[model samples]
Target: MKKLTILFLAMVIFSCNNQPDKGASDNNSEIASQGKIPKTEKEVGSNTTINDYSQVETEKAVEPDTIKTNDNQDINYQPADNNNTNQFEDNFIGFASFYMQFDKPKQTFILKADEDKTITCKEGTKLTVNENSFITSSGDSVTGDIEIRVKEYYKISDILLANLSTTSNRDILETGGMIYIEAFSNGEECELKKGATIEIAFPAKDKKDDMQLFSGNWESDKVNWILKETIPVDSEENAGFTFVEKMPEFPGGQQKLMDYLSKNIKYPTRAKESGIQGTVYITFIVNEDGNTEDIRVVRGVDSSLNQAAISAIEQMPKWTPGKQGGEYVKVNMNLPIRFSLGGEDFSTNNIDYAKEFEKQVNDSNLSNTEMLEISHYIFSTSKLGWINCDRFFRDNSPKVDFLVNIGTSKQVDIKIVFNTINSILTGSTSGGKYIFDNVPTGHSVTLVALKYEKDQYYLAIKKTKITREEEQVLDFEPVTMARLKAEMEKLNRI
Candidate 1:
C-alpha cells in the first residue's frame, strides 16, 4: 500500500506540472480569435513569421522605446527597438516605407486593421533584397523620397487603384504599371530592421486583378520596389479597359507599311527645287473594316508634300483592324511623312538647303496660293509655317493681345480671328493671354470666348478695330462661382 501511494503521488505531481497556466490559456484563446497562433520558442527566428526574434541578436532582453519616425521625412540612422517578439494575425496590414536614400535598407510599417494600431514584428520573414535603379522624365536618376498614399481599400471585392506619388504630387497608380507588391506570412512592424531586407510574395491566383500586395520602400514620391506579389484575385475581367490587348497592325506588318511608304512616295518638283524637306504630320482613322479614311494633315510643312502624303495614305490597302473586347473597332492613327533630301538628292550640295528654302519663302511677295505653296514647303521641311502665311510678307502688320480673365482658372480656351485683306488669322490663348503677331491695319477683328458651365455653352463676343504697328489688348469678363450659380438657377427655371 505504501509503494502504491508513493507511485500515485508521483503521477499526480507530474500531471500538475504538465498542465498549461490559466493566464497562458486565456492569452492563447485571444491569439486564436484574432486568426493567428503564437510562434513556439523554437520557431522565433524561422521563415514562418515576419517577426523573427532570432534575427535580432540581443545580449539580453531590455525595455523598448516608443519612438515614432516623422512621416514624409528622411529617416536618419536612429535605430528603433529590435528585441520585441510580439506577433500579429494575418488580417494586419504592412505598408512599404520608401526611404529617400538609395543606399539605405528598406523597412515595412505594420498596422493592425481591426485595432487600428501598430503591431509587434517577428524576424525571419523571407527577404529578397535587390538594388533597383530608375530614371525620371528629365533623364536624371531618381534621388528624392517617393510617397505612396493608399487612397481607398476595395475590401478585395472591387477594383483598387492606389495613388502613387511623384515629387510634385500623387497620381493614381496606373494599371499594368511597374509597381507591384506581395505580403509575408507575419504582419508586424517590429520584424523590420533599419537595414534588413524582406521577401515579397504574390498570394493572388490572378495577378491581373485590381488589388494586390505591394511591398517595398519609397524614396520621396518615388517608388523603389524590390518585389511584387498578388493576393486572391477574381477571375472575371475588369469592367473598363483603356488600352487594347493588341494594337492594330498593318496588313503585312509595320515593315510592310514602311516599305509601301518608301515605294509609293514621290517628291514634288516644286518642293524638291525649293529645298522643302521636313515631316508632314497626318492623322487618319482606320475603320472597323480595315479601310483608311478621314486623312488630314494636322501639321503641314508644304502643300505639295502634304498632298504627297495624303495621296499615299488614300492608296493604302486595308489593314488588320484594332480589336477592343474581342470586337473590331475604329482607331485613329497619326503618321509622319519625312521629306528629307538625302541619298542622291542633297548629298553633294554645299548649301544649308533647309535654311535657304526658309529665306526664299520669306523674300517672296506672292499670291495667297503661292504663299500657301511656300508655306507648305517651309512646313513640310521643318514644321515652321503652321499659322497665317501673310505675316511673312507684310512688314508693318498690326498686333493684338487678348488678356482673358477667368478668375484664377487657366483651364479655359480662348479663340480670336483677325481678318485682313481676304485672309483670316486665327490665334489661341497660352495661359489666358493670346497674341496676334501680324495683322493688317484698319481691319475689324472678332474675339470669342466659349465657356462651358455644367455642360451648357456660354459664348462671349467682341468686335474691335486693328491699328497698324500698335499693340491692342482686350479683356473678357471673369467667370465666377456666383455667375455659374446664377446661370444654373436661370437654366433650372427654363
Candidate 2:
C-alpha cells in the first residue's frame, strides 16, 4: 500500500516536470484478444482496507543507458527517472462513431493515469485493458508509444454539445445518451448515479457519420439483422456474402430460441453457489443468409458452463428481420443470458427442448465399414450445388489424405490429422489412398470418412486381413449441415 502510494506520487511529480511534445496526430486502432469488442479497465475505487495491497511489489528496474538520444549519445537514461520529458502520456482516450455503422456521432476524450500509478478504478476512471480484458499494467508511458483507454467515466452533455454544429442536429441534441457511474459498497453493488460520468467514449452514429462498413438492414420485427461484413480485404472469402434486399428472416426465431434455451441452457450451479450473479454475455454474428455463425461467449463464468451457453446459441435458428434503407441487413448483436440453479429445466410441458435437438451430436460412424463405402464419391449432378467432401469425414476417416475438389473452389488440400497417428490409416505410404493388393485376404474391418480441418481428410475404413478377397467401390455422400450435426449426436448416444 505504501509503495503504491509512493509510486503514484512519483508519477504525478513526473507529469509536472516532464511534458513531452506530442505530435499533432491521433491514430486510433482497436485490437482483439480472448473475446468480443476489444476494451478494458482496472479495478477502481476499491476498498483499500479489504483488497490486499501488502504483497504488491514496486515496479521492476530497467538497465540504464537504454534510452538513446537523437544523436545516439550515451546520456545514460534510466527508466525510473521521473524527470525524463521524453516519455509519452500513459493515459489516452478513444472515440469511435457508432458500431460498424455510418452516420454515428463521435467523441474525443482525454485519458488520465500513468502505468506506474498502481491505481485502482474509481467509479469514473478509464483503463487500458490487456489480453485478459483487465488492466494489469498502466501500459506504455513513452511519448511516441502511448495507449489510449478510459476507465469508467461518461461524457458530459456540455462536452457532447461542443461536438455538434447546430441545435437541429439529431445526434448532439439527444440528451439521454449521457453516461453514469456508481461505486460498489459493503454488500450492495454500486449503481450509477443519475448524472455521474460514464466514460462512454464510443458514440452512436448520427446523421452525418461515415458509411463505408456500417451499412446494414433490419427485418420488420427488428429482432433479426444482416449486418455488413467487417472482414479484411485480403481474406480468402473475399466476395463475402451478397447483400440481402429484405429484412433478415430467421428460420427458427423465437421457437428455436426457446428450444435452444431449454435443451442447452444449463445453470452453473457451482458458480451460482459462489454467488457470481453477473449475466452471461453471448455475442455472435448473423449472416445475410440468416444463419447464426461465429457463436461465442463474450463474458464467461466456468469453462464447461461457458461451452454449454455457446452450444445453445450455436444451435439456434436462422434469424429474420434486419434492414438498412428498408432492406434486410446482417448484424452482430450482444446478447445477455441469465442463469440460476432454478434454470435447470428451461422447458414447459408443451415443449420438450431436447426433443427439438433435431440431430445427434457425434459421428462415431467413422468406425463403420459401410459408412466409408457409402461416402466415397460424389454423385454427378448432385443435389448440392457444391459438395464439401472434407465435411463428410469430419475428424474421422480411414484414408488420411484429405482432398476436396468442388466445382471451382480453391484446390482443397488433403492431409490426415488424427487423434492418434500410429493407427492403421495414418501411416499408409500412398497418402492414405487405399490399395487392395497390399492386404491379406479374409479380414473384416470398418471404414468411415473423416475430416478434421483443411489439408486433412481420411477414410474410416478398416483393413480386414480377409482370406477371402472381395473388392467393392464405395461412394460417400455429403450430408447437410443439419444432418452432419445429427450424426454427431447419434455418436454421442453410444
Candidate 3:
C-alpha cells in the first residue's frame, strides 16, 4: 500500500509538469494569428504585451521611405502598388485638385429670370439675355432669380493655370480668348431655353479676321472645341483699299508715330529680366472715320512684349483717313515696334533712339496701302458653357511624340507650354510614361510637372527644344505654396 501511494504521487507530478499554461498558449496563438513574433516573459516588460513588444521591434527594424532632392527638400516616399491601377489615376486627380486653385474666380450675378438683362463683366465682355431665357436641365422653365457665373480667360497665364489648351478635334488652334458661362436656379444647374438666345460681345484688341465661334465639349478633364458658327463681318469694313490716292497718315505723321511708340511702349518687366528683345509686327485698320479698328499682332516675340506693343497701338489717336477715288476709305497699316534693352536705363522713356531711327528709315519700304479683313464676332447662342474665339493653328513643321519619364510610380500632373504660341498641352500617362503626341518638332517648349502628396507640393520644370521623339527624366523637389505660385507666375511670361 505504501509503494502504490508513492507511484500515484509520481504520476500526478508528471502530468502536472507535461500540461501547458493556458494563458501563455492563448497569448501566443493570438500573436501568431496577427503575424507578430511571440516574446518570452523575460523579453517582454511587465506592463507590455507580446504583441506590443513585437510591434516595437518591427517598427525599429524598418525605416521610413523618403527621398532627398538636390535642393535639400525632403519628400516622404511611398511605393505605389503595381497591382492597383486606380491608385495612379487617383494621384493624378489629386494633383489636378491642388493645381486648380490657381484658376480665375467666377464672377457671379443674380438676375430676375422674368426680366431682360444686359450684364457687363469687369473685363469688358457684354452679355445680353432676354426675359424667360433660362430652363432647367429637364427642359422645365425656370422662374425667379437665376445665378449667372462668368469666367473670362484673356491672358496666357490664365489659360495655363486653368489647364486649358487651344485645340479643336485634335487640331491646333490659336485663341483670341475663351469664356466660361453657367447658370443656376435654386442651386441646380440650368440651361438656355430653346429658341431663346444670349448675345455675347467679347472685346478683342488683337482681333483676327479668321476668328470663329467654338463650343467646348468637356470630355473628362479637358475641353475639345467644336467649330460652331462663322462670325459675321460687315462687307463695308472688309472692303478696305489696298491702293489709295491718299494714304492714311498717323495724326502727326510717321515721325510722331515712332515717337509715340518710344514714349508709350513700356518694356515688360518680365521680358527685360529674361533678356527678351525683338520686333512685334502689329497690323491695324484706319477706318474712313479716322479711327483705328481691328488691331492685331501679325507676328509676336514674347506675350508680355506683344501685349505691350498692342496696348500702345490701341491707345493711338484718330489718324487722317485714306482717300480712294476721291472718297474716304479704310486702309491697312503694319507697324514694327522694336523692343531693345541695350542701354542701362530700361524705362519706357529711355527707349533705344538709334533703333527707332533705324526702324523709321526702314519704314519707307513698307506698304501704307493694304486691304484689311474685318472681324465682328457678335454672336447669339442658346447654349451656355465654354465659348471660345479661335482660329486654326497653321504649322508646317514635322510632328513627333514627346515622352517624360519621372522615374517614379507616383502619378504626376504634366503640362507642355509652347514657347512661341499661345498653346498648352496636358500630358497623359501610358505604361508608366507621360506622353504628349504630335508635338511640333524643332520648337522650344517648357515641360512642367506637379505633384501633391501627404500635404506636400512638389514641382519640376525643364526648358528644352523638341528635336525628335525624346524622353526626358524629371526629378521633382518639394516646394512651398508661395514658391510654387512664383514658379507658375514665371510660366505666364513664357
Candidate 4:
C-alpha cells in the first residue's frame, strides 16, 4: 500500500539561528546593528534609565523639503542632522492615510509611553487624502478619503484625537464599507529626532507599498504617539469576516515559518518520557501590528506538549499582517504542531489515500480501469488538469483534482475549497477557470469567487462533488450585498 508519503516524511529540525536575519525577527537588533541607538540618558520626571527602545532611529526616513508655518513663516525642515536641531529631548512625527469606506464607524487609539513629551502641532496640521472609487450594493459609486480637521482636535496628557473625517457624505459607513488607517509602527525606523520643535511629515505612497505602509522616525525623550481615538468600525451587523484583498503572510512566507518551527520547536522531555505524541492544535490572533497574541492550545494531547507548542509559537517573528478593503485588521489563525517520536503507528487514522481512491471510483459509477483512463486523459490533455497532475506527481503522490469553470469573461479571483480533505493544493488561472488539486478523491468541494474592484468585493460561490479528475462548469450570479451580509452573520454564529 502506498501511504501518503508526503505527509509522513520525517522532518529534520535544526537548532535555532541566533543571528537575526534582516526583517526576520522583531526586536531592536536592527537598530543596534545599524548603530542608531542613542546614548543612554536619565529619565526626566522618573528614576529609570531611558533605553534604546525609546530612542528614534532616523536611518531610513527622508524629511520634507518645506515646512508650512502657521504664521506664514517659511521654516526650513531637515531630517535629524546630528546638530543642535537634534536635541536630546526632541521628537519627530510622521503621518500617512488611505481612502477607505468603513462598514461601521471604526474607533482607533494612539498609545503613548508614560515618558512621552507633550505633543505640539506648531503649524496647523491638515492633510487631504484623495478619494478612491468604491461601489455600493445598490450599484452606487462612492469615493473614500479622510481629511484632518485640525480645528476639532482633542488633547489630553497622553492621548490626542485623530481629527479625521470622511470625504463623501454618504452613510456608506455601515457594515461592509471599507476604510484605511495606517498603523504607526509598520515601517522602517530612522533616528531623526532633533531640537525642541517637533516636526511631522507624510510620505507619498509607493506603487508597491501596502495601504498602511508608513516609514518614518518618531522621536522624543521617549517615543511619543500623535493620534489617539478609540474608533471602532463594524464590518457587519454581526461579527463578520471582511475578506482581504491580500492575506497576512509570514515574513519569508510559509516555508520560512515551517523552517522556523522546525528549528525552534522542542519536544517536551516529560511528554516524550510519558510517551505522549500527537498533534497539538493551536490558535492565535494576528493583530493589525503583525504581532501574534492570545495563543492557546485548542486541542492538546498533554499539558507538557501544550506548553511546548505555546512556547514555540511565542518565539515566532511578526507577520506582514492582514488587510481588508485596504485597511489592516486583526486576523485569527490556527496551526497544528505535530509531536511524534520514531516507530509511531502509521494507520488510516492519519490519512487513507487508497480507500478514498476506491470510494471515488464507486461514487463515479465507473470501473477502476475506466477512472484511471479518465484521470490519464485529464492529466495528458487539459492544461489546468495537467498542471494539477504535475503538482500531485511532483511529490510522488496522486490526488484528485477539482476544476471549476466560472463561465465568465471577467477576471475574478477564485478559491477552490474541499470541505472534507487533507493535503489540499492551490492553483490559479489567467481567466475564469480555477483548479484545486491534491484533494481527497471521494469528497465534495466548494468554489468561492470574489471580484475586488476599487474598495469593494463582489462574491460568487458554487459547490460540487469530487470524483477522479473532472471539470465542473458553474452558473453563479453575483452575490448580493444582502446575501453577503447574511453570510457574514452565519459565520459569526459559527
Provide the clashing-pair count of each candidate structure.
Answer: 42, 102, 0, 30
Q: For model 2, how many clashes?
A: 102
Mind giving the per-residue lDDT tens digits that candidate 2 earns over 1-494? 11000000000000000011110111112223211222211223222222321112112122221322223332221123354322321111111111111111211121222222122233212211111111212321222111221122122212111111111111111111211121222313222222211211122222111111111111110111111222211112412222222324346543344344645565555655664433455666666566777677766656756776677668766677455455444544445454434322222122121223212211222111111000011111101000110111122213222222222212111111121111112111143343222222222433333321121121222222223324333333433323333433332222
lDDT of 4 at 124: 19
Instruction: Write the residue-wise lDDT of candidate 3 on 364-398 in tens digits.
Output: 22223121222224556667777886778778999
- After superposition on all C-alphas, the RMSD of every candidate to the true structure, in Å, is 33.1, 31.1, 29.9, 26.8
Give the Å error, residue 270, model 1.
1.0
State how far residue 78 of model 2 sits from its true place (Å): 58
Expressed as tens digits, the lDDT of each residue in 190-248 for candidate 1 is 11222222222211112232222222233321222222321111112321111232345
> Which ranges in model 1 have alpha carbons more than 4 Å from their true place?
1-175, 178-243, 343-494
Per-residue lDDT, model 1, residue 69, is 23
Give the alpha carbon lDDT tens digit for every residue of 46-165 in model 4. Answer: 222123222221121212223222233332322333544334112211110000010222122222222222111222121111122122324333222111111111111001011121
Off by over 4 Å in 3: 1-93, 138-144, 186-188, 231-377, 452-455
User: What is the Cα-based lDDT of residue 474 in candidate 1?
Assistant: 39
**Runs with alpha carbons beyond 4 Å of true place in candidate 4:** 1-243, 343-494
Question: How many Å off is the CA of 447 in candidate 1?
Answer: 64
Q: Give the range where candidate 2 is weakest over 10 consecutive residues by summed lDDT.
A: 6-15
The model with the greatest TM-score is 3
Q: Is candidate 1 or candidate 4 better by lDDT?
A: 4
C-alpha TM-scores of all predictions: 0.29, 0.26, 0.52, 0.26
lDDT of 1 at 194: 24
